[model samples]
Target: MRFDTRLVHAGHELAEGTGDVVPPLHLASTYAHGVQDPPAYFYARGENPTREALERALAALEDVRFATVFASGQAAGATALATLAGAGRVIVSDDVYGGTYALLTSSRLDVRPVDLADPAAVADAFADPWAAEALVWVETPTNPMLKVADLAEVCRRAHARGCLVLVDNTLAGPALQQPLRWGADVTLCSTTKSVAGHLDVLGGALVHDRADLHDLFTTHRTTTGSVPSPFDSFLVHRGLKTLSLRTARQVETAGKLASALRESPHVAEVRYPGLPGHPGHEVAARQMSGFGSVVAFRYRADVAGLLRRSRYFADAVSLGGVRSLAQCPATTTHRPIPPDVRLRLGITDDLVRLSVGIEDPEDLLEDLLQALSPS
Candidate 1:
């Protein structure tokens, strides 16, 4: 089956005897075991039927062999570093998510920030002696800034030096982009965002094609007890069915919003890969199926007032939900980074990040325009 068809049927097996179409939500923490032969699932921490279904669906969507689901995106990230990074340095994109920034900086890993959007900078970073046996972390169409990286180039450079590459695929879920196809060794995602579609579920996943990496991540998840609940797994799995549809509408709306923002006199700058003016537009066009649903722009007027006046867009943090969300990255998502450092990265106080939802495009656009217009 194709990608969209697989989304509906990948992990679904009709309930035995009942012939129910939807997969059953298995909630049992422990399964019955015999003396001679142990059960496939003895405990929930190591295994759960519902969670396994979600993992299978995730792996199928990424066109990979394995996937390990986590309680949160941070847990998945921490496990990826712990199991794969070894004792070598970890090179990350400079415009990474605040949680990711804090995770590497606070840990013992030798974390170095590199401008991953620039191929020359990536080449230079990999040339460094410290980069040998390192892990290169990438977040394309990166958090808040919407900067897309050249995945194939970075993967080529990193693999040339025997280094592994992990891509945070939260901003552009599998429906829009599959990093493994572009040579990413592992794809990390916040299932709490796009994968779940609705805002209710909180989970994460790391999808890859290697059995060795899968075994390592699964072991870490089991040992650390960082597994998602059966219900969260069910929610995310259900969300998978509509991913292609939701992403398409959201991407269409996002392009409209980006174009509108650029024309707004109250807006200073607009950042969206769909825009030809964006630095990473070409690479994004080549790698991703769609430009994604997030549109970020620098508001020339009061950011707080804009947030307060918007009727449809919620003043919130997370993205890829059914409802539109607006946030000031300098204060919300990227607050962990120092002001000076954030300024250097173009994350100004006036920057407003919008996660375009499945709402009517005209309504969303009018709300944004009125909010940005003189109060």
Candidate 2:
């Protein structure tokens, strides 16, 4: 079956008692395991029916055999990275989410920040003999930057060097891209984003192709107690049903916005994989079936004027929500990082990132036109 078709059907079993079409949420903290037939669910921390249903659906979406859920994307990412503890080194993308950068740098592993998008640069990062045991963390259509990484190349080189590769598929979402098929050992995503769609729930997911790695992540998740609640899991399960349609609408709007923004004289630069001039356009086209909603562009003039004049977008931080959002990454999302680090990353004060929504394309375009009139 096609992806959209499978999305609606996969991992969904009829509710046992009432024969409900959707899987019923099981909220029990602990389940009874009979002597005659032991139930698969035992405890909330170890496992839960609601969370398992979401995990199974996620696993199927990413074409993987196993998946685990977490309270937040950070928890999922941290737990997945923790699996590389005691390894000689870990390589991370320089422009990844600020939270991810903090988690890796402060950890026991020698985290090395590099441009994982550049296969050669990543290969050079592991030049040292100890790096043979390294782990690589990547993000394509990276946070705020909208840069696409060559996950396939990174996975190929890492696997050849006997290193594990974990690709954060948050920005593109599994609806657009699947890193595992590109040879990545594992895939990470913030289900809170496009997966949950409504912005009402927060959740994270880790998908692994290898059994041993899946077991390792499950153990870490259980030990650290970083799993998501049953209710949140249930919400995300419902969200998955509309992910395809929501993402498609948002992606279309984003493409139009990126094009319109480029025509404005106030805009200095536009960063979007869908843009022809973008460095990663070809790579993104090769790996992803669709370009995501988020768009980043540089506005040399005062952003406060732009923000105030805007009538539609909420001046907010989070992305992949049903409503449009706009934010200055330097002040909001990447504020934790030093000014110099952000500058080097091209996250300037004048830069604005837009998370386009499922709203009408004309409405969003008019909002941008009026708000950006001064630009």
User: TM-score winner among the candidates?
Assistant: 1
- lDDT score, candidate 1: 0.92
- Candidate 2 per-residue lDDT, tens place, 100-195, comes to 877776777787788876667877876757667688888888998987888777877777778888889999899999999999878889999999
RMSD of 1: 1.2
| C-alpha local distance difference test of each model | 0.92, 0.86
Q: In candidate 1, what residue range of length 10 has the lowest lDDT sum?
A: 32-41
Question: Residue 374 error for model 2, in Å?
Answer: 3.0
The TM-score obtained by model 1 is 0.98
For model 2, the stretches where C-alpha displacement exceeds 4 angstroms are none
